[model samples]
Each structure stands twice: as structure tokens, then as C-alpha cells.
Target: MRSLDFPALIYILLPEVFRIIELFHFHKQVNMYESQITLVMDTICPWTYLGKKRLDEALAQFRASPSSSSISFDLQFSSYQPSPSRPETIPDRAAHALHEKHNDNEEAQKLFEEHMISLAKPLNIPIAFTGPTGNSFPAHRIIQQVQESHGPEVTNKLVDALFRLYFAEGRHPGEDDMLIEACVEAGVGEKEAKDLVGDKTKGERKTKEDIRSIGMDIDSVPTVIIEGRRRDLTLTGLKEVSEYVKAMETIKKEST
Candidate 1:
């Protein structure tokens, strides 16, 4: 391409060229075709921990691909409580998981627990089902506040911390102090987290909107919904990394 000498060019042409430069920056700042992923999950869900690892792996693969490098992946997480009606605290989350997963089958319960353990081995992310179950509503609220003020990168950190506290540390999500500590460790200030800790109005509103945005009621945990490029993708429950890879590929094709 030949260089344009703006100083020597006519004033009218210079205005047009300036306009072109402005448009370039404008488009670069906002591209609607970029993938938008919304993960709806509860903090107590063990499989969600695994699903997140797989999604990260899939995204890493996408980032490495030359063709996909030009686009961006926008991630947002929504809150979903498995037992919404229950109080913020529960006696035994481990037993709950067993019953929910195996449906009272002892052999299947063992296998399910084993599967959860095995899923985290290769990813290097730890998870265990030996903790108490608590309402994830408050944690969800904190995430919502983080997402609003700090953006997705910080929000992701908070999410990882919450999952770590729940599964690896055996901490209950119902407690506000634990959530506040996790948030501070994840980059949120102590005062900021405490102020918004148990406040669920914003989180509940946004979560309902997120569910409506996906146009479906997510009954189970670990559900992922990706929107953009004329394609809407949803993956529920456990799946291989290859599955997420394929979904991204399909989205890339539709976008083209």
C-alpha cells in the first residue's frame, strides 16, 4: 500500500483519512463477534470445578491457534443454587453430593466420588467432597459485585478462590467471613467485600437475567453458554476438553 502524505493532501481528504483512523480504533475497542461465555454454576458443585479446568484448557488451545488469535473470548459467570429453598447452611455437603449423584446407590456413589477425584488429577486442581454444604447465594453476590467493579479477570480470580475454599479447604460457603477472606486473597479489599457480602439483590437480579439471556432454566451445575457470531452454544454437566474445543471451532466457523 502507498503511504498518504496527509500534509500535502487536500484538507477534505485529510478529514476522511482521520475519520478512517478513528473508525479503526472504535472497531478495535468493541467487536460484537467475539465469543461471550456465561458459566452458570453453584459454589458447592464439585463437577463445576472440573468443568472450569476443562474450559480453561480449551481456551488455551484456542489462544494458541493462529486463526483464533485475532478474536477474543469474553467470560462471565452467573450464580445458581442447587437447593435454593434451603437455608444458607447445611450439615453435610458430602452426603448430599453422594445422594444427588448416586441416587442412594452405594456402588455408584463410590464410583462417582472416584470420578470426581480422577477428574482433577491431570488438571492439577484439587477437589474433594468431604465438606458441609452451604448456600452459595452470598458467594454469588460477592462475585456479582466483583464482576461489576473489577471486571472479568478479577472476577475469575475470585471464582477460583471460592472453589478452592469450598473443595480443597473444606470451608462452607454459607459463612460470610470465609467468603470475605477469599475475596481479599483474590484481590478484593476486605471492607469492600464485607459491605457487599450477604447482599443478594444485585446478584439475584443479574442471575435471573443471565438465565433469561440463555433462554433456558439451568437445573444442574456446570452449565456453560457461549453466545456470539450468530451461534449460541451450551454445554451442560461434564464433558471432555475436546468437546469444548469443538464448540469453539463450531463458533469460529459460524462467525466466518
Candidate 2:
């Protein structure tokens, strides 16, 4: 037999070695489990924003863990309106509405505000009830349209932008300007966003249907539903990051 040169031998074997490595990675990816996390929330709800931030933290923790290699996640947001009776554009500030809800008791309002601030402090979210309170239909419509067209990632970004605009910047959530700005921030073209915002009737029926569907099951915002392999896990209200991580671990264990 003729002697094989070392360099030529390596060159001949390198293609097969790379092919095997590629196959291994492809197989691993194919075998990973997929979990869907659906968040039912409104754009203007401060608690919902906190919930989203916490859930994101939990997901990051889980992704960094060893179990993440076996699983993938799909995050989605569903629309819900806490005050469906309010007009699309309201003149009263959110603080006034909150105070009115508590029968205009200044003490009660102060206590509630303090409670919100305390809860938000740990999460690093600036909870300001300074913006105008309205129907939230416009924001919901824009989010629904984005979700349909751009998928969950973009929709989540848009939701975050809207939250920041309202809670941190004290802007009206239902205003066209806010919606358009959020869309642009979420990577949608300004013209497309304008078109989406200009069409007043776009996503109205679907938003209403989603609101009705979600409302029938839960009367609260920030309800999270995780669709797992065996059964669905529902987490209501704001939860600790560890709690969410535990839920994901349970799902991952079941996946095995």
C-alpha cells in the first residue's frame, strides 16, 4: 500500500468530520422541546409590565441553565382591556381614575400609590400613574396587528415600548402618536406603522374577540399561561422569577 501523507490525509478526513459535527447539531436541535408562553395583558397596566419584566428574567435564567439545551420557548402576548367602558380617548389622568375608583379617598389613593411604588422598586420598574387613562383599544389593535404580521418577538418589543411610553414617559397609551412611535421602535417601517395606525378599523374585531375570550376566563390582567407537553400551566398575577423558573423546570421534566 502507498504511504498517505499527513496533510493530505487530514484534508480528506476534514470534510467527513465537519459533516458529522453538523449532523450532530442538527439532530440536537430537532429533538429539543418547544414550550409556548402566552401572556394576557393590556398595554397600560403597570402590573402587567412588571409581570413581563419578571417573566423575561425567569426565561433568561432558564435559558442559561443546563435544561435549556433540551427546550425552546415561544413567547406571545394576548390583548385584554381592564376598563372596556372607558372612551377611546379620556381626558382624565390615570391618577384621577385610580382615585375615583377608590371613591376619591386621598388616604386610600396615597396608600395604593405607595404600595405600587414599593412593588415596583424591587423590579426596577418606574411605576408612574401620571398618564391619561383611556380605553386602550388603539394600543391593543396595533399590538394585535403587529403580532399577526411580525410575530411574537416584534409584538413583545412593541408592547414594551408602549409600556415605557405610558409608565415612564406619562404618554397616553391610546393615542395614534404613541402607537406609531412604539411600532417604529419595534422595527416596523414608519409608513407601515402609519398605515396600521391610520386604519381605525384594523384589528378591531379581533381585538374585541380576544378581549372577550380572555375576559371570560380571567377577570385580571397579567395572567400567564404556559402550554407544556402534558398539560397547560396557568400563572395568575405577578410572580417571582424563581416561581417562573420552577414552572419551566416542571415543564422540562415532563418533557422527558
Q: What are the lDDT figures for the candidates, one per model?
A: 0.79, 0.87
Off by over 4 Å in 2: 1-13
The estimated TM-scores of all candidates read: 0.79, 0.92
* lDDT by residue for model 2 (125-235), tens: 888877576778888889889999999889889988998898888888788898899999999999999999999898888789989888989989799898888988899
Number of backbone-clashing residue pairs for each candidate, in the order shown? 0, 0
Best by lDDT: 2
Q: Report the C-alpha lDDT of model 1 over 137-204, residue by residue, as the tens digit.
A: 67876787788899999898889888888889888886877888888988887887787775657566
In model 1, the worst 10-residue window by lDDT is 207-216
118 Cα displacement, candidate 1 (Å): 1.3
Give the clashing pairs for model 2.
none
Question: Clashing residue pairs, candidate 1?
Answer: none
TM-score of 1: 0.79
